[model samples]
Target: MRLFGRKNGEDDSAERIAEFWRWWEGARPGLDAKVAAGGRDSLASLAETLAPAVSALHSGLVCEVAPGRNAAHALVVTAAGDAELRSLAHRWALAAPPADLVWEFHPSRQANPQAADLTLRAGDYEFGVGKLVLGLRVPRGAPRVDVSAYHPIFSELDDDTRLDAALLALDSVLGEDDVARWVGEITAVTFQPIDAVPAVHLPAVVADLASEFDGEQWVALEGKTARGRPLIAAARFPLRPVDHPLYDQHLAVTLPYAGRDGDKLPTGASVEALRDFEERLTRVAGDWVLAAHLSAEGHRIFHLYADPAGEVRRQVEELAATWGEGKARVDVAGDPAWSAVAAFIS
Candidate 1:
């Protein structure tokens, strides 16, 4: 039944689940508050009864949530010790495979045919898995699963199992075309697939590919396999020229921009700005290097490839702050060995 951490006379699993509910209900205010505060003891008490059911699911359970829904911070931990115990609400649903599972996202006090129609809020967004409604109040025209970076805990099954978890996760936000486009972009079936290679040999493949496609255009679109099995990236960059020496040349020289007091941001920007920011960066720094593209999900990413100099680091940091808080990161590399840093925007 439940995996008990220690030999406690009382049901530890139940206690943990109850603790989870308390945290979940408190996560978003409004009606959730009533459920979280009013049913604290009872929820914990019910956890004792549900412990056996909850433990039947997956092993090494972990739940990752954006701290304060900050989007920039992704906090991850095991189910038992997570900061957002509220995520336990989906334990029952996540344990089952995609086919056997049924869920919904509804917050109103009404009966539905859905199995786990539950609701929970993360940041200002509402997440509904199955029949569950995560957020009590939905923002004006906010698409479901608006915030990126979430993984559904699926049971390990046969390789033939083509469960599109990414598509389903944000079905509320994405249309069929959108989902298809994303899947197509990330899991391009046109690429060749090899046999089940050794796990230890992945680094070698990456290294070889990096060397072969050094001057070529490429992006690790999705760090996942085509058949939902583990996969690596081999897609070549299609937008830019291969011999672009901008990124590489910049890696040779130390940065020149540093030491800013107030926000040293570039002026004149709007949502409809026709100029591509990535292209702008390339053009601005064009004097020393060739052009390059930023990652696909470039919303909150920080892309800076500077030389291996201490002063470069400081300048890059200042640039990131000035350019508005994005997914801040810095990359520095010598001829072969490349160094990198990356941060996620919440």
Candidate 2:
């Protein structure tokens, strides 16, 4: 029940990250000894050192030690279902010390096969994973899956506590990262429904649904600006914010091209320059992170999402400055909900 990390703004730099690893290298032996001796509060007791060090990287990030997949333990840095901080947890895990026999690193809570037989206690309620039942809902024509969880203990707990346990059970089976990406709204019910499947089947059910979203799909959206001016956009389908939890930060680039046939889409030599801009921007992105490419009124707007820790803003701004057609404007904002592109996404 003790959450680790500070309640202060994060310091995103190499210094804090390096400092944690340096401390980790020295503390490993002690930690291993404590765990090996079966200390009841082994990892939890390290809040003084381990907690502050990690909180320095990002206040929202918290760590816990769990039964490992292969190693003796897994040092998991989890975002606790906060999509905005998911990327930061991943970044922190990426900077971990190389793998060793004692510990493995995880960016998010992972599926634990052992959890199936585990009994979890919260307040006066005690329950095991086996007591849980799951119901899945796949919305028609949507790219995601919705899940409902049922447990007798839920009937005794408050709404918030019940949901916390339900999510915990799901994360234990489906893994945090995947659940964040592929799963949508979660509902908690005290009684098992006829359609409810056993908790153990959640992984397979979610896997089958996730596989459907494996390939890329896009849709064209035709709309008009506030002034009633016509605009068109090509955007990815199944545009769920959960799909790209890490892409919380948003970037919008306004590229003005002289050549266009009133649709505002790029044309002539301007088309080549816009493509070059896209290529350069993607290199900065290192992937096709474009949320949408829209032609609005007289200018072309590119909607993009990225990790705030990355130099996306600076890099994209630099590219805009070198725009050939005319002066380009780059705007960036933290948009973890991805609401900026709502108009474009179908």
Candidate 3:
């Protein structure tokens, strides 16, 4: 009796599947062409048939079906009545020619406008046919889901009950052939786990210094001293001199500091002091000093990219007299190595 019932159930499933295919084939031409032509009426018609199925999967669901590449179909599912429809329009795309599908879900859609939390992908792996940008978010107090079955989709399933129901539905609806096809497509795509890449480790002192100078104008490099103390170096390109014609013949002047009153550097003193000193230097040197660098040894190196007026040395001397307090020794060089250093530091 059990065997007979199983045979009957299989026959019924096959008949239903055949019916679905027939309906799809009849609707394909009109739906595909109209959607490809960007017809709203056709989309609404297609949505009438598809929306219920998607809504059953998720409450308050909005479903959109449109033409995809080569007479294929694309489906976008989102929260109902979302005013920002354009943002979710590309969430799920399906192509039938080579049997491809792509799905992206943004858990923090409002907080992060450009974030894609989880991505489900299948089909041709190369030429970007099945590519996904993965960085999923798990709700703070939600239960975790098993990831072995479908890693990307699993990352999205924070509600355990919903996940179980969805899994059951998927298993019931998908046949052996369907599962095989999906598995094949999924296996074909390549993916890298987010945890695979090692995190950058910075010493505490370097991190603190970097935080202080973090801005659009400066880039900081972290190194280590002889005794393993964190050494921080920074570079900045002055906007004023960058647009000048004499930008290429710059000389870099290095001035060492020991934190004494006469050898104090403005950057080491305070952020405001650094800004004030930079402004004064720019005013005095004009277009000659195009950039600047603060070395790990606390040396302020000025990039005088042009010395057309032969005033590079004079400018360095003036800077030392005004800000260096008579203890700073200015070494000005116009060598090719200095230019290379300036290029690198800037």
Candidate number achieving the greatest lDDT relative to the actual structure: 2
What does candidate 2's lDDT look like per residue over 1-346, in tens digits?
Answer: 2223323655434455666777788887777777776765655675444666677666788887778888888888888877667666766678898877778999888987766797776567788998799888889866667878899888899888898888888888888866776777898887787788888888787778767767878888888878887887788775665556567778889988898876665568877777788787767753227888887766889999876766777888887888877889888777776778866543
- Candidate 1 lDDT by residue in tens digits, 1-346: 4433334544244456454445434432433333335444643443444334334322434333211222222222223322122223233223322221111221111121232353433333444545211211113322111222222222232222213332333322332222221212222121123332221232233344335434645444434223343322223342221112122212321121222222321224422221243444444432233222222122223334432323544544445444443334444443211122211100
Whole-model lDDT, model 3: 0.38
Better of 1 and 3 by lDDT: 3
Per-residue lDDT tens digits for candidate 3, residues 284-308, read 6444544555544455555555544
User: Pairs clashing in candidate 2?
Assistant: none
Each candidate: RMSD to true structure?
A: 21.3, 4.2, 22.8
TM-score of each: 0.20, 0.81, 0.29
Where model 3 places Cα greater than 4 Å from the true spot, the runs are 1-216, 225-229, 237-250, 256-275, 310-312, 324-326, 336-346
TM-score-best of 2 and 3: 2
Report, for every candidate in turn, its global Cα lDDT versus the true structure: 0.30, 0.76, 0.38
Candidate 2: C-alpha lDDT: 0.76
